[model samples]
Target: MGRRKPNETMRLLVATFIGIVLGFFLGVSFPTLSLTKLNLPSSLFPSIDLTYIEDKYSGLSTQALLNAWSSLQGKDGSAAEINEFNESRIWVPTNPRGAERLPPGIIASESDFYLRRLWGSPDEDLKMRPKYLVTFTVGYEQRKNIDAAIKKFSEDFTIVLFHYDGRTTEWDEYEWSKNAIHISAPKQTKWWYAKRFLHPDIVAAYDYIFIWDEDLGVEHFNAEKYLRLVKKHGLEISQPGLEPNNGLTWQMTKRREDSEVHKDTEEKPGWCSDPHLPPCAGFVEIMAPVFSRNAWRCVWHMIQNDLVHGWGLDFALRRCVEPAHEKIGVVDAQWIVHQSVPSLGNQVRPKALIALGLSFIDMVFTSLSFKSCQGKAESGKAPWEGVRERCRKEWRMFQERMSSAERAYYVSLGIDPPNSTTAR
Candidate 1:
């Protein structure tokens, strides 16, 4: 090829430079072309207004809009708060970064979706503020503790009590403030039965619901601040009284071992400790958790599984919170005391052992029949067979660990190691 003239080359280079500058301007000026409203399925969620888009896009160039949208999608306070408000029909005029609307369907800044949903609609009247419904399952023995806790927190929140026996006579015997609602549950039901029996009315009557164990005590609990935080953060499930270092010990199968280890590793703080994980994984003891209306609805439906009963409440909660990708906040600002309860095996002794053995067998059978493993047998592998093997390994590990721990505890208690065959 012949060499181009110097003048010709210079002209071509200048033209290319101009084109690039123009392209950059155009890209920034018009990043997103049209705003379409998606009529989401009724089963998924209700329709949301595209009110805040114009505000977000008003003065933003294409590049700025792109950056702003990307930033708004993450878990930062602005994004979370805005998303929460949108769920509640509140409009935030700008994106989380305080950018004017560059897109439609965006929410306002400083909005709390949890509060919006709970309150349902805004009211001009202050006295008609939304109330809280607190529900729990209690036996006759734990009444005093429940009563004391309620009385202490009564001024802070509206209290609603649910008795497992479904009898109102006992509840009526004690005079309480006008704000408290006491309802009875049906007399003989499965163990994981509290939410379903009590939720419908609670959901209808209250802006938020708190589910708890009856044996819990509130010494330094701040119900107002907790409620305010829930409203501000737009959290679905908030656990205020969760013990920082406590959680259930699952029998880890091999498949679960990796996950367990990964979770445990994440719990460690660096040289400077992170407040998020203070020596625990899992969650607060299911002793007390505050649930927004949306959370209550989600959890109530998930808790309906027949396989879940008295002992599996925590497992059921994990499935609900994790799969939905919803936040389960544990508040450490306030504290509530839980009277430690015996383990399932110890609670009922020989009877509980038989029940636990049967439950374990049922869990194994259910895993085998699960739909995910339907065709795995053709490949000479069973889906849950791996889980079973893992469980066996976990059982052995747990036995060894527990034996050591028990021996140490017994020694501290000044008891001699038992020679009984079942003692291990």
Candidate 2:
């Protein structure tokens, strides 16, 4: 073939360079853009499939997408690994002191009637019964009660106690019980305490992991029946603690418009019939959620968030549970009384201010991006209408909610609400 003309060669080179520059800029700027839209020619970008490219770069570190998987992997021995247990059931007892607070009558009733019926009746279809009961004790005062409860239940199931406290010197106390596993919660945030103490190794000991807050008392609680329900429903992440008064309590009202619409059809089943609505199957309060080994493993991978204190539980739950497309079942059959009632004390005011400030920042960022993108599209500078509309709606909601949350937090903190000038 004859050599290309000098002008032709220059034009080809310039076009290739421009394409590369555009791809890099688009990838960096609109990091959330779906990879399918890249529409990269297969021949030129043969090594990278645009569809799969998003997974590889979905939470690219520099883009601030917060790669949860990456964060988990960065921790020592904390890479997301799946381990399964052969036994279908695991029993969990809250630490002794927490259990002691439970009504003795209620506990006895569950142990005699509910626990036995479930464990005794073998499912002919599944041909297995839940065998192990795991209990965790944190403070010294609760250990005695926990140990006694475990001993009482030892005949029906394998009772295991997981103890954690850096100050404890009696490591040998648990040596007698083959069922018990002792671990320490290093002086760290409650978030890390759960992660490290509730490590995958301990979780791998059974198929179904029951994470019970110590204060829960089983009253008409049938462990076998609950497991059967979990198995029947094929629940990956399940909760059997407190049920919401109404579904409206669970509704994420402040999400972006598209998100709200999508949630209506996808996440939630019903439309907002009334402007003042309650949540349908409201958010899970994480007090006594049970995870199939799979769910625990998936959630475990997301525990290493930047929020060191316990404040990020809800945020992490939303991120992990929502993305997995798993439903959190609030079991109304049995209710666990939460002993340590959450209160907004001295630090609450500061935390509220911080949350409001962050919300404001998020709103501003989302709004500016949406408005500019929408304006460009309207001005015929961009061709993608769907992208622009979605961005605009999301930003608008963010702006509105951020302002509202800031005001509410300030009022709760006994401070003057920020004016538009302060907001700026």
Candidate 3:
């Protein structure tokens, strides 16, 4: 086939987009539309059914959308509620003791429930559950990732921002519309926040909990459909299928637009050979994993305090879900791109002087980089060699620590631990 003219191609693209928009409106308007007749591709009318949209999208009912449309004509005259929780809550005087007035017998500075949030509050009272409570661990150094997440999820889901840099002052510039919860800490990985702040029991009110990296491209992801696919296929823990050209590391994650969802894929030999394990089994990279409420309860306890990078968790996820090959998987119906932005670790540490840029101090810290530089020169290894070696060492250490803990428990019970030679 020959390529079309530029003007013709643009017209066709615009027309297709208009059709999609029309289809969405039609689905909402025509209540008679049958779920049985909507057998289109996963990329097409996958959401012609209400089950997926109801899970995410805050379950905005057809009547609600219709009401919003009707209100567009200046009919209802009542402002639609936005940030309802905050609106309903009452604010008290900041200086409790100095206040000239106090309500009846109410204690000063005790007008609202605030401090218990640290213990992980449930959202069950909200009437509708968000498919996932999106948690983004950020340093506030780069605004792009955080901004994208807030923009996409603020309207529909509960967003929890974990600030590692502890810079609450800089957050005002971002217009969150008071829809997100902002928590700041000195420095802690996303896993640490999950283990401490987002206890699974507390978050059981939500259907799924998305523990994800800050940097991602959701251009092709449909959160509602992603939830539907995971629930439909019984995936306890899963991640969106990643774009192949997005610097992804495994074949199982690479998105296949033709498939609605994929649990396994053909991978190169040596990636994992069990066939029951990943890059094939019920496992996905932690870069962006969505956990079912029950599964998150198991995963939460598995996170170790000192293993900050979480290098070894993916391989061991099977321990949390039985028949792991069937329960842990990836979604291909709609996918996301891994920005692969190194926003998490080693942000300021230098491995070599030659790689340095001009500092405002007007000096290159060659002396500070001396040991690493000399070590690399003598060993004929790249700076990445050190990182890879360190990752391997940490992974080994984490495994041994887990095994030793189990062994100690067995010893205390007057019995030997399972044979280490057979597995570890």
Task: Give the winner by lDDT: 1 or 2.
Answer: 1
Q: Which residue runs does candidate 1 get wrong by more than 4 Å? A: 1-130, 155-158, 165-167, 177-179, 185-195, 198-205, 232-234, 243-284, 305-313, 316-326, 341-424
lDDT of 1: 0.47
Ten-residue stretch with the least lDDT total in model 2: 341-350
Q: Model 3, 1-424: lDDT tens per residue?
A: 9989999999999999999999888877764543435655666754465544333343355676666566466444445443442244334334343341344346433221122233445653344435458888776665666686656563457778777778766777877724567777765667767777887656776678888777778877767767878889999989988989864667888888888777777777666666777667767887789888788888888888766656667777777888888998888877887765544433333323236553422121222211111122227754434444545555677778777887998999999687542111
Question: TM-scores of all models?
Answer: 0.41, 0.38, 0.57
For candidate 3, the TM-score is 0.57
Tell me the lDDT of model 3 at 93.
38
Count steric clashes of candidate 2: 15
lDDT digits (tens) for residues 13-111 of candidate 2: 999999999987876675576758767667887777686555444534434433433444545533223112112112223423334335444553212
Q: Return the top candidate by TM-score.
A: 3
Cα lDDT listed for each candidate: 0.47, 0.43, 0.65
Query: CA shift at 39, candidate 1, in angstroms?
Result: 33
Off by over 4 Å in 3: 1-131, 154-156, 344-390, 404-424
